[model samples]
Target: MNADELYPKRVRSQKSDARRNLSFASRRRNPNLRMCQLLHLQHLDASESKINGSSICNIRSVTSLNLCGCTNITDMRLIGICTLPQLTRLSISWCVNIKGHIIGCGMSNLTYLELRGCDGLRDVNLNDISALLHLEHLDLGNCNNITGASICNISTLTSLNLTGSGCITDKGLSGGLSTLRQLQKKKQVTGSCLHSMPSLRRLNVSRCWRVHDENLRQMSTLTKLRYLDLSGCAVTGSTLGSISTLTHLDLSRCWDVTDVGISALSTLPELQHLTLCNCQKILGATLCRLPALRVLNVSGCSQITDVMLRAICALPQLEHVDLSDCATIMT
Candidate 1:
């Protein structure tokens, strides 16, 4: 009897995927398959089943695993995945039932881990997770229960995404900054505040209602920052000014940000991807000044007109542009 069938269809599909994965793992008859060698596995809409953890143990060669939208999962199933000594990348976004630690001691080698939308997750021991020194990317989006204490330990992290993590505040981020010394050189630690992650390359704190630019400005110390998302944040023009090396900027849903803030982006000569979705105050003229711009999304910006579209087209590197929902544009 397939216990998975008795549950929702999502559960059934998760079990089916696990079965297929187990079958594939069983086929790898070559014992010479190097565990340290890189491997990539992407499974969309994965569900949780009792069989998944055991199947993960069989795929010793897998290094990167992306299981996006695996809502049917809880914590125990992912424990099996942690045992893989070479595993690095793992994305379990929208996996609602994953309430606690799935991989503790075994995740020492993990470089990238995304737990976005794991709403039920409330507790995570910072000490256990801080062991992963190789970590570069981590996403904790929409986990309202997580507090600042757990985040404080991950100072070695380079790329972090906390979009919609409502519970986080400057206090938690500040704690994280304080602990960064052991992970990087002393010069990398510039700001006395939370944003002082010196080696950081990508930072997404969008919709973190509690965070303000005062603490966020400390991120200017990270001279290598390439991507920054301040949408729905209290960030103003000065915040953008600090990050002059940014190549991608997303300021969507930022009602407080006006043309003055948009102008600050012009200082970023490397900027290529820009999203100004629903920010009505920025004028069409402001869009034309961006040099080296390629992908621009101005959806829901009613203030923009055909002139704004023409300005975007004038950019020699512009390859993709989206003006959807812009009421002022007729064609």
Candidate 2:
């Protein structure tokens, strides 16, 4: 007789007992039961799981955890997660309930943290996360409460996304980013207390209305940048010469950028992705110099006719092109 049919109740109890008795070694030998426990788990994606605090407390040995969209999660649950020693990456994006001084709870080992769309987060001090020496990637996009002071102490950060974080003004950028850049460059100087994070590669400050030419000029010190998104910022052509290392540039909706600003981008030989959507000033024919361009978006550029298309087609690597809302492009 089958084990289930022979002794249904007793068999189920025995199986549970057997599972409980199974050691880490035995679990490793049985690959099928890998998900039975957290001992060997290195990554956990509980996004949108509606999981509770007790469930999260049971998880250990996981290096990466994605709790994105876990709307039910609160700061009380995060206290339990802080006990996880090996957690290196944590994504709590859109978890609105997680607000106010949550990172100070033993999250020093985290290298990547995403708090995007966490609108409830306000007036958080960056000094709280300053102890995280290995932190490289931090996304605070749409977290309007986060100011420039929130990033001053994180000198190890390489990628930072502050899209739509209106609270960050020129003072904050200068205090944090400009100071960090200076600290990184002056490593040989004596009595330099600041740690070097010269590895900064990507920065997105899009929709920061307070960002003007002065702010962009200050950002030019970040020479290692590969991807930069300054869309909707108040910058002019003069800001382009400083960031010649950029490969992916997004200037969409920047009404201030005219042919002069577009002409300045020709110096960026590494540029691959270019977005100029809603830029009403571009009259066309200046993009042919960029040979590495693969993606181009000129949507809402009313003056762009077949002349711009001809310049874009010359790019041998061009793979994606968006000309939507262009009145001159024939159907």
Candidate 3:
């Protein structure tokens, strides 16, 4: 009589049951049609699925949605997504069809948003996103159109990824990041100091060629930073001297950094993961000075021979070491 009562018998049948087979095929073709019945669904990962914007609107209770690599998604579909009142985390990475003016709607509960490689997204308005007071983690990596002003208002953000977003310049950091340092000082005076001085913990600006020494000087004020990636930027060893709070640092492809710059890292007592891939100038003298160093990536550092390897092996805490492409290292 009912669809549920008939499904069990249909599945057990060996005969060519046309009605039962058609029903199963229909459900497979339109998975969203069945998902609409699941009112309590909290997480939906319809990534790379044929599900369109209209189908997504049916799942109203979802809090986390990952539509990454869904090239078919458009700006109109994003409008439907805003209506989901419980949504807090959304990842639309590589969704190139999602263009301008798509974020300013009713996503007040959103805390984490990822728009990496969203090529169509241009002229994004920060005013729309500023309403999300709870927003913390944002990844605009490879979104070339993003400027500094677009993120200046989001002072509540803790983790930001801007890798390959070269349009962002020193002016952008001055406007947005400067406020974070001020907030940290205010929190310290109020005796609400948590783990570090600033709320920001992780930041990646790799391949952002416009970022230079002055920007690093400004970033040094974020005393709470534990993870920082400045690979492929225009900074020298002098910049490393400014930030002593960093634990995980990635300076891969930083050709300008020499042995003198490596010495500055000695001040970071809590340093652990250090990536110096392609830093050919470092001869490995300062490598042993890091007392807490655990993971070290010195791949492509041809200057590092057995002498450097000996110093690296002497570190009692060292666990993982990347000596790939080192011509002088014996075995």
Deviating ranges (above 4 Å) for candidate 2 = 1-38, 69-72, 99-102, 117-125, 176-199, 236-238, 289-295, 307-321
| Model 3 per-residue lDDT tens digits across residues 1-331 | 1112222212224333422122333456555656556566565666665656676677777777777777888888889998899888888888888884768588889988887787666545656777788887677767877764567677677666665665654445445443242221100011112223255666665665555665576656677778877787666756676678888999989888888888888888889999999988888888888879999999999989897799788998899999999888996
Q: Across residues 1-331, which tens digit of lDDT does each residue of candidate 1 receive?
A: 1112212122124644443232223224434543322133222123342223435555665555655565555577777777877676666767666675644568777877777777876646445667778776666767778765676676666655665666655545666543232121111112244444555665655665545556556667778778776676555555676777888888888777777777777777898999988887767686677878999998998888787688778988889998899988997
Q: Against the hidden reference, what TM-scores do the models get?
A: 0.64, 0.70, 0.75
Among the numbered candidates, top TM-score falls to 3
Clashing pairs in 2: none
Q: Which 10 successive residues of model 1 have the least lDDT summed?
A: 181-190
Candidate 2 C-alpha error for residue 46, in Å: 2.8
lDDT of each: 0.62, 0.66, 0.69
- Tens-place lDDT per residue, model 2, 1-331, is 1112211221113654443233333445565764436455565565665655456556576676777788888888888887888888778888888884667568778878887778877645466766787887677767877665657677776656665565654445444443232111111111111113334466555665555665565546567778777777676555675777889888898889887777778888888999999999887677776788899999999998886687778789899999999998885
Order by TM-score, highest first? 3, 2, 1
Candidate 1 runs further than 4 Å off: 1-46, 52-103, 106-124, 133-145, 161-166, 176-193, 211-216, 234-239, 307-312
62: Cα error in model 1, Å: 6.5
Which pairs clash inside model 3? none
Judged by lDDT relative to the true structure, which candidate is superior, 2 or 3? 3
TM-score of 3: 0.75
